[model samples]
Target chain A: MYDTNYHRASSVEEAVKLRSSQDEARYLSGGMTLIATMKQRLAAPSDLVDLRHVASMKGISVEGRKVRIGAGTTHAEVASSSALKSVCPAICHLAGMIGDPHVRHMGTIGGSVANNDPAADYPSAVLALNATVVTDRREIVADDYFQGMFDTALEEGELITAITFEAPEKAGYAKFPNPASRYALTGVFVAKGASGVRVAVTGAGSNGVFRATDIEIALSASWSSDFVASVAVDAGQLMEDMHATPEYRANLVKVMAKRAVAMAG
Target chain B: MAKVTLTVNGRTMSGECDDRTLLVHFIRDKLGLTGTHVGCDTTQCGACVVHMDGKSVKSCSILAVQAAGSSVTTIEGIASQGELHPVQAAFNQHHGLQCGFCTPGMVMTAVDMINRHGGQLDEVTVRHELEGNICRCTGYHNIVKAVLSANEEMHGASRQAAE
Candidate 1:
């Protein structure tokens, strides 16, 4: 890793100030991905504004059907949260399935969502649940929050404080994890709520995490695993990598969607 | 340069290192506690696992400055009074090591896993939880046996004492 200054920010305001003060500074939350990226020389910021100590940005709270997860809340915290599990067990289960125990101990919901890795697990939940991304400055709805792979609507120096969403009637996530890295080869998250059925696919989309409208429409009509299985995903729109061909990923999309629907039921 | 201070094992230590120095390097080089190994610096191979503030984390992936003020426990810290920790003893008895390259990380990870899951751990759970820590040797058969045995010994003994 390149030499850089590190500053521990205790509050969102201080974190933002620290970030803006440097020409190239990135918010360090969990540092699961950022640190690894830096070690590989993929990212070399002039300074790192560590947000791990930011008090207001670290927790999970659920009241009735409303759920709010602080950006700094670690995956392990989310996975083990009884309050969150009571209302939204699917999200909790998804959290438990990320990278591994050690990585989950340091990876945060905010960092995962902020990074918006196409293969990341959290974006599927965020998008499928239709959560709202609360930043220091504004609240962006999930639809508007995710722009593309490794891209989001977050402005530079803007920090995500929390994510809020209504507990869906039923929600489940299923992923075909890559054997080595455990990243989602093709993952699907399905949710049924007041807004109706929402299906989000991650790890396969060439354009990043995206809504599977055909499956969503089918599930809304029939609400069955068989319906999901019948919905054909276009291989042309998916990504082809060394691990899987786009056609195989397309098939996995349906298989995982079917499994997700079964799990949600 | 960053002056990083943290409590390693039970000892509060301070050191000066580059801001980019990994916690593993700081522990092994700066503090001269070389038990922690760095098998894969990219974070996949869990040869650098350590307990940070009571949770297992990849020390190689964390910067020394980021760990400042936090309490860390490394492989060197587990033994007491020259007596081997139960996990270490279990590994030794169960023949869990071959090259011994991944033992420190395996032991640290096993300690954390046993702490969290307790004596009720099954083979599947132990194997699943061992996902982060990779062992190319031993085929992980005896390592899994060692973790389970240690878990039972630690938590089961505590349960027996309570009863």
Candidate 2:
């Protein structure tokens, strides 16, 4: 690890200012990812702007059907929140299943969403929930937020403040996690909301998380496992890795979708 | 060097370290608390786990400066006065370790699991919760037993205190 300057930003405005002034600064949330990268000598920024203490960026709020979660909130906090459970238990369940208890305690949803790892759990949730990625600058809808694996639409100095979404009529998530790392092998999120039916697949996308539109259309007409089971997702569009082949991931997409719908029902 | 101040095991400790220094290194090299081990520095191994503001986290994955103003508890803090914490005592009684390399992290993680699960705990749940804390010695049979026993004893003591 190389020597760097550390700054604790008390406010979002101050955080932006700190980021702008530094020659090379990285925002620190929980340090679950960044610090590890630094220790591996993969990245060495000149400064670190700590955002863990900004009081305004922490909380879980559910008004009517809209759920707004602070960006700084930890996965463990989101997992255990009864307030969130009342409206969106799927999110709670999703957060609970991320990287075991220790990782959940240190990893933040904002960090996960920002990092946009192909195997991360939150991107599917955001895409499936039709959520808004609220940032210090402006709101980026889930559709426009994720650009690709390890990519997002967030501009330089843009900091995510919160994620807001409507509680779906029904939503369920299922993930086939890699045993060693606990990252998803192929995860599917299914939701039937007032807007329409949504199907977001993560951990199996060659281009990162993608919406399975065909699966959505089939489920929209009839919410049945038999129908979802019969749907053949294109294996070409899915990612192939050591844990799973493209055909295997394509199969997992279908299996996880059926399971998610069953759980949602 | 960056200035960081935080409470460690009830003592307000301050130190000057490189901004890249990990919290585990600060605890071990700077503060001279060698109990927290760093097995896999990439956060896969829970050997460096410690309570950051009352939540168990892999300390090696966290920078020392990130922990400024936060309270941290390590394995050395689990005992009260001269008496071992129930979890520690249970490990002794159950023969939960061999080389004892992963004991500190296992103990800290167990304390956290018991804290959250409360009285409603089972062996299966214990096994699931202990996934992050890997123990090569003893095959984890004794470690699992120790965690269950500790939960029982700790919960029993709390009940007696309440009564």
Candidate 3:
């Protein structure tokens, strides 16, 4: 890894101040992806503003149906959170399935969402659950937050403080993970709430996590596993790699959607 | 250079390293504790697993400065009074290792897994929890056995003490 300056920020204001002071500074949450990327020489920032110690950005609070998860909250914490599980177990189950125990220990929801890795688990949950991305500056709805794979609407020097969403009445997630890397080959999250039925697909989308409006429409009409399975996912917009063909990924979208619907039931 | 101070193996140690120096390198080169192995510099392999503030994490992916003021436990810290930890003893008794490259990380991960899951671990649960720790030798059959047996022994002992 290239030489860089590391500064630990104790508060959101300090974190933003420290980041702006350096020309090429990146906010370091869990460093699960950033550190690994830096080690590979793929990214080399001049400075890193560590946000793991920020007191206000590290917890899960649930009030009625609204759930707020601090950006600094680790995946492990999310997976074990009984409060979150009680309201929306699908997110907890999804959190538990990310990487392995060690990776989950250090990876954070904010970092994962901020990175917006196409294959990441949180983006699907964020999008499907209709969560709001609360930054240090303002709140952005999920639809506007995710721009594309590894891209977000977050401006330069902006920091995500928390994510808030109303717990869906029924929700479930299913992923077909790559055997070696454990990233989702294709993952689907299905949720039914006041906003109506929403289906989000991750890992397969060439443009990143996206709403499967067709599947959502089908589920909204029937709300059954059979209906989800019958919805054909178009392969044109899906990504194809060594692990799977676009057609296969398209099929996985339906299969995972079906499974998620079953799980929700 | 960055000055990082942290408690490792119950010893408060401080060292100066490059800001980018990984926690595994700090533990190995600076502190002279080489028990924590770095199998894959990439995060995929679990050969560099260690307990940071009592939770298992990939040491290779964490910078030394990021760990300052945190309590870390390496493979070298698990034994008590020259006696092997129950997990280590179980690994020895169950032939959980061959070539031994991944043992430190495997052992560390297993200790953490047992701590969290307790003695009621089943085969499937142990295998799932060992996902981060990769064992190229013995096909992980013996490693899984060692972890399960160690869980039983440790939990049984704790239960007896409570009784």
lDDT of each: 0.95, 0.91, 0.94
Candidate 1: what lDDT? 0.95
Q: For candidate 3, give the lDDT of residue A64.
A: 97
Model 1's C-alpha root-mean-square deviation from the true structure amounts to 0.7
Displacement of residue B29 (Cα, Å) in model 3 is 0.4
Q: DockQ for the candidate 2 complex?
A: 0.82
Which parts of model 1 have CA positions greater than 4 angstroms off?
Answer: none
lDDT of 1 by residue, A30-109 (tens): 99999999999999999999999999999998989999999999999999999998888999999999998999999999
TM-score of each: 0.99, 0.98, 0.99
RMSD over all Cα atoms, model 3 = 0.8
Instruction: Please state every model's RMSD to the true fold in angstroms.
Output: 0.7, 1.1, 0.8
Error at A217, model 2, angstroms = 1.0
Candidate 3: tens digits of C-alpha lDDT, residues B1-163: 8889999999999999999999999999999999999898898779999999999999999999999999999999999999999999999999999999999999999999999885779999999988888878789999999999999899988999999
Candidate 3 lDDT over A1-265, as tens digits, reads: 8889999999999999999998899999999999999998999999999998999999999999999999999999999999999999999999999999999999999999999999999999999999999999999999998999899999999999999999999999999999888899999999999899999999999999999999999999999998876777899999988888999999999999999999999
Separate clash counts for every candidate = 0, 0, 0
Error of 2 at A208 (Å): 0.8
Question: Candidate 3, what DockQ?
Answer: 0.92
